[model samples]
Target: MKRIALTVSAILLLFATAEPKQKKAQPKKQEATSVQQEAMKVLMSGFSTDPRFTWKTQQDEAQRICSQYPSMEAMPAQAIQKVIQLSQADLRYPQWGIFWGDWREGKKIVENPRGGRFASYGFSDSPTDKGGNCYACHLIEKGMPGGTMGPNLYQYGKRWNITKENMNTQEALERVKAVYNIIYNSWSAFPCSSMPRFGHNGALSPEDVMNIVTYLLHPDSPVNK
Candidate 1:
């Protein structure tokens, strides 16, 4: 028993005096930097720009600003306002004097899923391969399977007080312009919106945007009905 106790004491003493294993600190930011560089290199090697479609590989001023902040709430009011101002400066009004378009055509554009990231260079060369595909992000009609990425715009016109009954009124014109502005550059209205800048990026033409507006605001349109 005495010998066993002595052996145990010696073992305990050895353990108490033993050098502790040091945990190596991981340089997380450095590792992240290396991974990001590798990813960029891979992307650059794979993508080639063509006349019809080009990838926006480089970050723009607004994108850079937005990336630095996690969310719009985290961003400064001044910065948000600056994004709005910059976006508004790029706004292009419709060539036609009237903002309205045929809602029927608008419905076609909303449902069509052609020109977008999928239509980029080497994927499609058709000029008519572009459309709004608004239904992908909004529930604009009843019983239609739509993505829930954006808010339900089922009664957009009615909620906004836009109707065929109010079409010729001055209020309708102003509301039409407001919707036009949103479709043109959502960042103008919401500095860090997930919505695309359809008009600003030339993804959708002025006429195309007007058509979408008609689908949303027309009284007889499914969105309003």
Candidate 2:
């Protein structure tokens, strides 16, 4: 009993004399985040702006959220819905109830890729100078070769049953509106779409978009042939 008491006392004395352990400092995660943000700012500042190609340094809410996650699959359903809602809110419809335009003009825009690009920085921001480059990712024309990045849009109007006869019908108009929404901000229609937000990103104007709609939906368009 005495030995046990002495051993306990010795243990207590040793503990009392021992110094407290200090915790090692953690790596500063926020510091890395700040540095990453600053680096992006610096990179963005390197680009000079022109009339058509303005250097956008900041990300919008949808972009921010999308960037935070690698892909839409990495994001939750709520987050995906949030991006869609934000894109939908910013959608700008065509003015004066004019949804369709000259399909010939639309074909020109679709065939050309140099329009409105940074490469065309010095040129005027005219419709003739800007292009949708739709052929880069879609097979719009039947025999013409196109990129396979996007789906084939051959006979798009025919598939939708849109023709010159019923192009002015209420249902056709609704279809036009749907197409406009898809082209304006594809993410609005599909939250995880890889398609570019042509209107939202300022790559295409309202008039340009309407013309593209015509190219895809007009009965007289070569796309329908």
Candidate 3:
């Protein structure tokens, strides 16, 4: 009876201390949330409510879910699957199909460092000024200076064993399709990836994405050489 009474006393003391600590933690969490909201409001105040800018500020369903976590590794399995499902559902392919486009055009898009950027000081992008700016994230060609944010793509086609001899095979076509899907919507392959959903966001047309895929995977392209 004496030991049982001591154990009960310990439990009661722990509850008394923990309850106050939890109550104190609640206000801190609310304060942090309020600060974050205020910071976002301040950031949004700089941009105009124009239709072009509106899309940049708005979060879609996938983006909303992604924002809840700091990184993909931290995301729960359910959230990761949700993001993948959303990305796959949102994919749009070229009307011509998933065949590779002109690799030359793809090279230009990959190398060009211009795209949909907005600035109030006469630096806004025109509707026709579209580019993939792929070099900013990946090393596409040999000896090219590119950011290390994404994987090195030099000799990507050779690395994949893609060649003219087997280009027409069903396996080759499936590989091409997989690359196309990643370029169009990276989240389908890697949920909450740092890579942008180029085609899904209309940043790149289906034709443009196919061209990039060709540049990365075509045997004759400099990327393979």
Q: Which pairs of residues collide in model 1?
A: 115-129
- Give the higher-TM-score candidate: 1 or 3: 3
Candidate 1 per-residue lDDT, tens place, 1-225, comes to 787567545533432223121123356445545655665565556557663434467656776566556579988888898899888898887778556788888887788876343333446635467777777788889888898998998978888887657887887888888888898889989887988888877677778778888888888898777
**Ranking, TM-score, top scorer first:** 3, 2, 1
Look at candidate 1 and tell me the lDDT of residue 189. 94
Over the full model, what C-alpha lDDT does candidate 1 score relative to the true structure?
A: 0.73
Local distance difference test, each candidate: 0.73, 0.74, 0.78
Tell how far residue 164 is off in model 3, in angstroms.
Answer: 0.4
Candidates ranked by lDDT = 3, 2, 1
Task: Identify the superior model by lDDT, candidate 1 or candidate 2.
Answer: 2
Write one digit per residue (lDDT tens) for candidate 2, span 1-225.
Answer: 787567544533432222121122234444444545555555445456653434455567887666555567778888898999999998887676655788888888789876445323455656566777888889889899998888899999888889778899899989988888898888898775778888887778777788888989899898988
What tens-digit string does per-residue lDDT give for candidate 3 at 1-225?
786567545533443334334456888656655655554565467668777567776679998777666678888899899999999999888898877689998888777777433322245445346777788888888888888899999988877778999987888888998889998899999888878788887778788889989999999899998
Off by over 4 Å in 1: 1-39, 49-55, 115-128
Poorly placed runs, candidate 3 (over 4 Å)? 1-37, 116-128
Q: Whole-model lDDT, candidate 2? A: 0.74
